[model samples]
Target: MVEAAQQPKRRKRIAMVHPKFPPSFWSFGFIKEIGGFKTVMPPLGLATLAALTPDEYDVVIVDENVEDIDFEINADLIVLSSMAIQEERMFEVADEFRRRGYFVCMGGPICNVLPGRCRPHCDVLFEGEGEYTWKQFLTEWEKGEHADNYVQEEKVDLRDTPPPRIDLLQTSAYRVGCIQTTRGCPFNCEFCDIIVTYGRKVRAKPIENVIKELQAWADAGVDFVTIADDNLVGDRVYAKKMLKAVGDWNRARRYPLAFYVEMSVDAARDVEFLELIRHANVVETFLGIESPRSEQLKETKKFQNAATPLLDAVKIIQSYGVVIAAGMIVGFDNDDVGIFEDQYTFLQMAGIPIAMLGILQAIPRTPLYERIEKAGRLRSAAQGNNTLSVTNIEPLKMTYEELVTGYRNLFVRSYTLDAIGERWLNNVKQWGSKRDVPPFPGKKPEDPNPADEPNRKWIQKPLGRPRIHLIFATLLILKYYFAGGKEKRNFALKMMWGTLKLQPAAFMQTMNYLAYFIHLREYAEKVVARDEKFNYVFDDKNLTAESLGEDGHINMVKNERSKKTKINVNDAYDGAEVTADIAADLEAVQAR
Candidate 1:
C-alpha cells in the first residue's frame, strides 16, 4: 500500500484529464497495429504544470483519457486540464471532488475561453497559459490566501518555459511521449481556434532548450518522441534550424528516437526543409487537406492551402519517403452531394492510405464564429453544450440532414472493409514497385547501437525468410511470365501475398478494422438519430439566426419552458369538489 505523510503536509493532489479522441478509422495502417494507441501520450500541459509546482506538493498524475483517477487516494487538491470537447465530464469530476471537500482548480483551452462558465464548479479557474498562472495559484493557496478565481498573465513568452515532469509519466504506455517546439500558427484559417488560444505570432522554444529536453528523454531511455507543434513547419527557417538541431543531436547519439510532427502542405515548397525533416528521422506528418474544392477552401479562408492539385501534392510529399496522414472535412458551405464521391476518388488517386473525414462545427472564439454570427448564422453559443451539427450557419447548398447523411455515406464507403483491403493492396503494390529507387541522397547509413550490441543475442531477432521470399519471387516471375499486358493485376496479387508474408501482424491489423467498420455502422446510426431530433425543432426560415441574440451568440437563455410547467390553474380546485368527480366514476363502475 502507498504511504501518506504525517500532518498530511497539506499535500496538493492533481489530476489531469485529456480530451476524448474523435473516432479515427484510418490512423493506424487500417488495422490495430501493435503500437496502435501508443500514440496517446501524457498531457504535456499538465506535465509542465507539475514541473512548475512546488516540490513540497505531492503530485499524482491521472490521465483519464488513458487511465482512471483513483478517488480512494485522499487529497487536499485536485487540478484538471481540459479542452472544449471534455468540459462536461471535467465539470462532473470537479463537482464530485468538491462534494468530497477537495479544492478543485481548472485550466487549459476550454477554461481559458470561458472562465465564468466554469467558475461555479472550480475554486480556481485559471485562464490563459498555465505555466506562470499555476505557480501563482499554488503560492496563494499555500499561504491560505486562495481566491475563487485566478487568471494567468496573458502573453507570457514560452521560450523560458520549464520542461515537463517526465518522471510522472507511464513511459511504457506510449510509443512516444509529446514535446512541443512551438505554440501557435501563422495562418488565419477561420475554422481554427489555435491562434485565438496561442496567438498568431508563433513562440518557439530555443533550439538548445529543445535539444536539452530530447537529451533528457534519451537519457531516460525513451525511444520515441513527437514534436507536438500545432504547425511544425509554419515558418520554414525556424523549422530547418530546429529539425537540424534535433537531427544533429540524434546523430551524435547515433539516432535514438523516431519522431512525428504536424505541418501544412506549404512545407512542400521548401526542398531543403523537406531534406532536414527526412534527415531528422521523422516518420509521419499529418497534413490538413481540409477540403479538396477551391471554393470551399476560400470560403473558410484556408487560402494558404487553396488552388493546389491535391493528388500531385500528395505524391510529391510521398516521394520524400515520409508517410502522410491527411485530414479532410465534409460540411463546408459549398459542399454538395458530389463531394462524397469526389473525396473518395481523391484519396484513391492521391494514394493516401489514411484520411480523417470530419463534420464541421463552430468552435469557440474563432473568426468563423464571428463571421457566421454576422451572417445571422449563430446556432447556439451555449459553448461546451454544442455537439454534432451544432454549427451556427446552414450548409448553403445542402440541407442539414443531407450534409449529415452525406458525411455518414462518405465515412461508410471510405472505411468499408473491402475498400480498406483494396487500399492496402494498392498501397503495398505502389510502394513495392518503387522499392528499387535508390536511398535518399545525403542521408547517412544508420550506425549500429553500441549498447544494443551487448544485449543483441538475448533480444529475439527476425528469423531468416529467404526461402519464403524465393517462393513468392518465383510465383511472381511465373505470373508476369504468363500474363501478357495485364501484369498490373499480377503485380497487385503478388504484393498482397508478399505483404501477408513479410508483415503478417500489420496484415492482421488491416483485417481487424472490419470489426471497427461494424462499430462505425452502429455509431453512424446514433448520429442519424440525433439528426432526426434536430429536424423536429428546426427553424427552416432562419436556421440558427432565430436562436442567437444580436451579438450573434447564444450566451444566455431564459428557462420559460420549465417555469410554465411548474404553475397550473387546476391546483386551486378544492378536494370536496374533486370528491363529486370520484363519486361519478364509482357510479359508472357500478352500472358497468
Candidate 2:
C-alpha cells in the first residue's frame, strides 16, 4: 500500500460573538445619548483569546451589546464567550449557527459554571480559564482534529499572558475601555463565586505586562479605562507597585488615561495605598460595602468591612477627588423588611453616588450555596447578574413578595432626583482641604477610623486640555438638563452650581451623576412596571434547568389575562419567563 500523506495546514476563519447583556443598572446605556457610545467596556476575554490564537487564523470579534452579530458570516469555526446571565441569547445564537452546519465552540464563565446545561448546545466546549486551555485547543485545531471539551486543571501564570487584541475592538462604540491586572481575591465572602472560580491566592500580571496593555489601549484611542479586577487591592504590596508603574507610564503620555477600580473598603485604611492610586490617576473606586449593618457583614464573613466603619471609609477615599461607588446588598439572612429603609438611609449618609444594590444571590458550589441548600432555602440556580433585583435563594427574614416589593421601591428611591443632588453635594463638601488639614482626620480629637476623619491627601491635578474638558462637562450638563423633565432641570441647576461653587474640581463628577440620574431612574421605572408575574419562575416546585424549556428559553405562554397562571408543584409547565421575554411575545402577537 502507498504511504498516506499528512493533511495540509489550513488557516481557518473564526468568528467570536459575545451575547447581548440584559438591561440592568450596569448597562449605563445613557452613554449612547450622552457620549454617543453604546457600551461601557469591551469584552476583554474574547479579545485576549484573539491575541492568543495563531496568526494564520482569521479572527473577528463581535460584541452583541455594541452591534448585532452577522448570523450568516463566512467562518470555519463559530466561537462564543458568555456569562451565565447571557445563556439564553448564547443558546439562541449557538443553535442558529449549528443549524447551518458550522462547528460552534463555546467557552468562558457560562461553561465553567453550568457545564451540563451548556454542553449539549455547542459542538465543542471549553471550561475553566481560557489562557492555557485555549492555546491547547488551537494546537489540535491546526492538526484538523480537537476534543469536544478542553478543561484547564491548573491556573494561568499572569506573567506568561499576552496583551489582549484591543486593536480588534470597535473602540468608538464604547465610552470606556477595560483591562484586567489581576485575578483571584483574598476575601471569602460567602456568596461570592469569584474566589471559587479563581481561588483565594491573588495573582497579578507583572507591572511591565500591564504597561503593554495600557499602551495598547491608549494607542487604540481608549482614554478612560476600567481595571476590571474583582479586587485590584487584593494584594496591597503588588497593588502599590502596579499603581506607581501605571502612574509613571501615564505621566510619560501627553494625554493621561483615567481608571476606575474595584477594591476592598479597607484600601482606604492605608494612606500610602490611596496616594499611589491617585498617583496612577484613578478617578473612582468601587467598594463592596455589602450592607450597612454590622450583623450582615458578620453573617457573610466579610470581616474586612467590619474592620472599619464603612461610612468613614467612603469619606476617606472621596477626599482624594476619587468618586465612591459601592456594591450593596439586601436580603441577607440578617435582613428584615426594615432593611430597605436602612439601606436607603445609609447610602444617603455615606454620600456615595453610585451604589450597585442587589438582592444577594446564593451562587452554586459556594459556602453560601451549601449553607442555603442544607437549610432548604436555596430555591433555584442563580441568574448571575446580581443587580437585577431578583436572586435564587429564598429570604429567611422576609417573604418573597416582600423581598421583591422592597427591592423595587429601593431602586426607585435610591435614584430619585432629590437624592441624586444631595449625594453629589455631600461628595464635594466632605473633601478635605489638602494643606491645612491635620494628619489624623475625622477627629474632634484625632480619630483614627479612616471614614470618621476627612482625608488630608487631596491634591489638584493639572487640567491637561482645559478647553476640551470644559466643553465636555458643559455639554453634559446642558444636554441632560434639556432632556430631563421640569424636576430634573431644577435639580441640575442646584447640583451644577453647588458643585462648582464648593469645589470646581468636582464639577465633572457632578455632571456625570446627572447622566446616572436619567439612566438609573428610567431603569428603575421599567423594572417596577414589570409584571411581577415573572417572579413566578421561583414558585415552581422541582424547577430545574429543564424547567426553563428544552431550548433553555423561559419561553412565554400565550394565556389570556384571566388565565394567568401561578406556579405550582404539579403545574407540568415546561417553560419559565423573564419580563423581556414576555414583552417579546407581546410584540409577536401584535405582528400577527
Candidate 3:
C-alpha cells in the first residue's frame, strides 16, 4: 500500500465519470428513440458509488452517453467506473485527468481484471466490490493516509448497501432506471467472469431495502426499472420474498412499474415462482441459452442450463406472459460446422425472436482464459462485444476464419427481414395464448373479468398507451407493409391486427421488438462488412503491411510485396512507406 501525504482537511469536489459505450446490439438506441430518451439506461454503478460518498463531499456525475464531460470543471478528485468495452476510453479519460494534476481513482470490472493496463493512468486503483472499500478509502483519504491501491478482501453484505443517489441522475435522459436486488450467480460457467469478480455465493439485499429503492424510483415518477442482477432467482426463497414485496408495492401505485431482469432457465421449473414473477410485472427476462447443444453445455460447465430442455424452458417462461430475450454463442469446443445451422434452427423452433448470437470469447480471469492460455491458443484480450465476429482464443475444431465467417453468416440469416418477422409472429402467438394467472388479489385491467360483461368501448381504449410509442408502431407497420413483399406485408398486417385485437397491452412490447430488429438488421450488416475488411489481419498465412502508395492512400499489403514499400526513411520496412514521425517511433522501438 502506497499511502498519500497528510494535507489540510476540507470538503472535496468529486467528479465521477461513466465512460461512453460503443454502439452494439445491447445499446438499444432505437428503443430509446421510440421511447423518448437519449440512452437506453443511466449509469447505475456511478450513481451507487455517488451514494456511497460522504455527504461532506460535493459530487457531480458525468455519463458520457447522455451528456458531454466538462473537462474544465474544478474538482479535487476524479473517479471512473467502466466495463471491458469502455477500457480504451477510460484509460484516455484517466490520463487526461492525471495530466491536469487531478487525483484520479478507478474501479469497476475492467480495472479489476486489467489493473496493469489502468494503474499507470490512475493515482488510486480499487479492485473488487467497493461497498465497504470505498468508505474505507474515503476515511483514509480524510486522514491523508489513502493507499494507492485499495483492494477489497471480503465480499460486501448486500443488506448494508445503500440506496443509490438517483437524484444525481438526469432521469429523463434514460429510457429505464436501474436497481440491483442481488449480486453473483450460482453456476460456474468456464467462460463467465461474474464468479471471479462477485464470487459464486449469491448475496441479496433485504426485501425492504429493494422496495425502498423502487419506492424512490416511483416517487421520482420513473416507471421502467431494470433489476440489474445477474440472476435474481439465484436464491429461490429470497426471490419469492422480493417479488411479492415488489408486486405489493407496484399494486399500491396508480402507475405500476414494469421490470426487466436477467435470470437462469431453471426459474421456469417452479410454477408458483413463475406466477409471482408475472404478478411483479416483469416485462422481459434475458436468459443465457448459450447453446442448444447439450454437449457444449457440459463442456462449458453450464450444467444448470442443461437441467431442462432449453426450448421447453423458454416456452414455460413465455407462457407466463414474459418476453424471452435469449443469448446464443457459437465457436464452442463441442461445436462443429453444423453448429451454425443447429443454432439457427433451434432459435426458430424455440420462438426466441430477439436472439443475441456471438462467437465465444475467452474473457480474462475466467477458467476458459486459463485453459486457452495453457493450451497456447490465447490470441488477444476480449474486445468485450460478444456479438462481433471476433474472439481472443484460437478455437479447437475450427480455424479463426471459419468461426468469423460462420458467426457473421449466422447474424445475417438470424436477423434478416423474413426471419425476424416469422420469429416475432410465432413468439406473439405463443405469448398471447399463455394463461398468466394474476398472483395478486386484484385482476390486471388487461385481464378479462368474468363478473362483468366485456364492453367494446373499454376494449377499444388501449391500456397504458403512450402516444409516441403508438405513432412509432404505426410508422413501423407502414414500413413493413410498403417496403416488403406479399409475405412480409401479410405478416405485418397480421401482427398489427393481432396485437390490437388479442393483446392490446402487449402493443408496446411488440413495437420494442420491431425497434430492436430495425437496429439489429443494420448493425448485423455492419458487422459483416467490418469482418470482411479485417479478415486479412487475422489470416495466419498472410503477411500484412501498411504501405503508403504514391496516390497517398494507405494500402494494406497481404502475402505479395509491393514495389512502393521502399522509402527514404531508414526505419521503413523494405517495401513500406513511413512518415518522419512514424520512422522515429519505429527507430525508438528498435533501440528498446
Candidate 4:
C-alpha cells in the first residue's frame, strides 16, 4: 500500500466512553443540580458510534455518566460503550486507556456479551450492533487495516442508520436528544435480552426518518427527544404510521421536539395511537409493568403483559396526557414471600411516579440463559461475569438471602417518605387535565446551552391539589439534610425554614421529590446491596467448580438443589392487584 500511503497519517484521535452509575445507578441524582428538572440521557449509542465515524476520524465524546471523561483529552483512540451495569466501569476504562498508550475500542451490551472477556483490556472489540460495526471500523481505519478484534457487524439495517452525530454531542451534558423509532421486542421476556439483542423482528425508522430526526432536534436547540424505543409500538401498522407521521410531523413543525417512549401496556389499545402520542408532545412513558401477576405473568414468558390490566393499562395510558414510567421486578419463578407487599401495594395504588424496581438479573444469551442452563437453574459462580452486581440466575423460589432480603424490602417499601408523598400526590392528581397547556406547544423555550444555565431552578407550574403542609416541607428538609447528622441538621433546618417560611407548593413538591428520593435512597442502600444471590441449595457435591469467582459460574451452577423451598405467604392483603381498562381507575392504582 505504497508504504501505507506515504507513511505518516496516524492522527485519528477518538474518545467516546460514557459510564458512571454510582449514586445507586442514578435512581435519581445524576448531579448537575439533580439532572436539572430531569431528562438527561444523551449518549445515543455512543453518539451513534460517533456518527459512523470516519470524517478522517477525530471524535471526542466522554460522558462518564453525564460528564467528566476528559482524561486530559488527548487521544489516538479510546471508544467505549457499556451496560452490564457498565462492566466495572468498562474494565476501568479499558485499563486506563491501555496504560495511556491509548488504543482501547470496546462496544456495548457489555461488549455484546463478552468479547472474549474484553480481550485482556481491549485494543478493539466492537461486537454486535454499532450500525455496521461503526462503518466497518471506519472502513478498516481508512485502509491502514487496523485490527485486534471486531467480530460483529450485526446492524440489522435499522433503516440504514446515520443521523446520530447529534452534532457530536457534549451539547451541554444533555437535557434530551436520543432517537429510535423502534427495533426489537416481540415478547419472549424470559428475563429479556431484548430478544437476544434486538431481534424478534420489529425494526423501524421511517416516517421521513422520524421527521428528519424531529427537524434535527428542532435545529439542535433540542427541547426533548427520547423515543429510544425498545418498542414504540413495534409495528402496529408501523406504529400507527409512525404516530400519524409524528402527528403530521408535529403539525408541520409547529410542535417542536418533545417525546419519550418505550411501550407495551398494549399502548392502551391505540386510542388513535394514544391521540397521536398526545398530539406529538409525548410527555412521558416507560411502561413494562412486569408483573401485576397472572401467575407472575406465566412465569416470565410475559405473554404480552398477560393481555393487559396493569392498573387498567396505566389508567388508559394516563388518560392520554402521557406520563407513566414503570417497570417492576424482584426475582421471579412464581414469586411469593408476599412479593414485596405485592409490589408495594402495586406502586402505592398505581399512580406510578416512576417505578423501575429491580433485582431479577440473569443476562447472557437469554431465554433466561437457556432456561436457567436447562433447569439446573444456573449460578455455578455466575459464568462469564457480566456484572450488574453479579446475578447469574437460579431462584425458583427464594433464599439468595430471601431474595436479597426481598430486594431490600422492595426498596424499603418503594422509596418511603410516605411512598414519595403518595406518588407525588397521585401524579399530581392523575396528570391533572393532562398538564393543561391548551396552547404553548409551539417552541418558545429553545434555550440549548444557555451559557451552561446560570443559577437554574424552575418547577412551579402545578397550581392545584398541593397542600398537606406543602407536602411535608421539601420532604422534611431532605429527610434532615440527606440523613447525616448535627442533630439532624438542626432539626432539618428548623423544619426546612418552616416549610420555606410557610408552604412554597409544599416546598416545591418537596424539592421535586427530593431530587428523586436522593437517588432512590442511595440506590436502595448501595448498588442494590451488591446484587447476586442464588442458593437454591441443591448441593454441588463438595463444592469448588474452582469455587467460581468471576461472578457465580451460572448462579453457582444453578444452586445444586440440596432442598431449598420456603416460599409461602398467604393474604398479605389478599392477593392485592387492581386494574380496570382506561383513564383513571384511580390513576391505575396510582401508577403501580
Each model's lDDT comes to 0.59, 0.72, 0.71, 0.60
Q: Candidate 3, which segments miss by more than 4 Å at Cα?
A: 1-10, 30-32, 436-491, 498-505, 531-592
TM-scores of all candidate predictions against the true structure: 0.72, 0.83, 0.82, 0.31
Q: Write the per-residue lDDT of candidate 4 for residues 496-569, one digit (tens) a residue.
A: 45445433323444354455555665555444443334221112322222222363222211122212432112
- When superposed on Cα atoms, how far off is each prediction in RMSD? 19.6, 12.4, 14.7, 22.2
lDDT of 4: 0.60
Q: Rank the candidates by lDDT, best first.
A: 2, 3, 4, 1
Model 2 CA lDDT for position 496: 81
| Candidate 1 deviant stretches above 4 angstroms | 1-39, 219-221, 381-392, 421-495, 498-592
Candidate 1's displacement at residue 326, Å, is 1.3
Q: How many backbone clashes does candidate 4 have?
A: 36
Residue pair clashes in candidate 1: 31-509, 377-392, 379-392
- The C-alpha stretches of model 2 lying farther than 4 A from their native spots are 1-9, 434-480, 528-592
Candidate 4's error at 432, in angstroms?
3.1
Ranking by TM-score: 2, 3, 1, 4
Q: How far off is residue 241 in model 1, in Å?
A: 0.9
Best by lDDT: 2
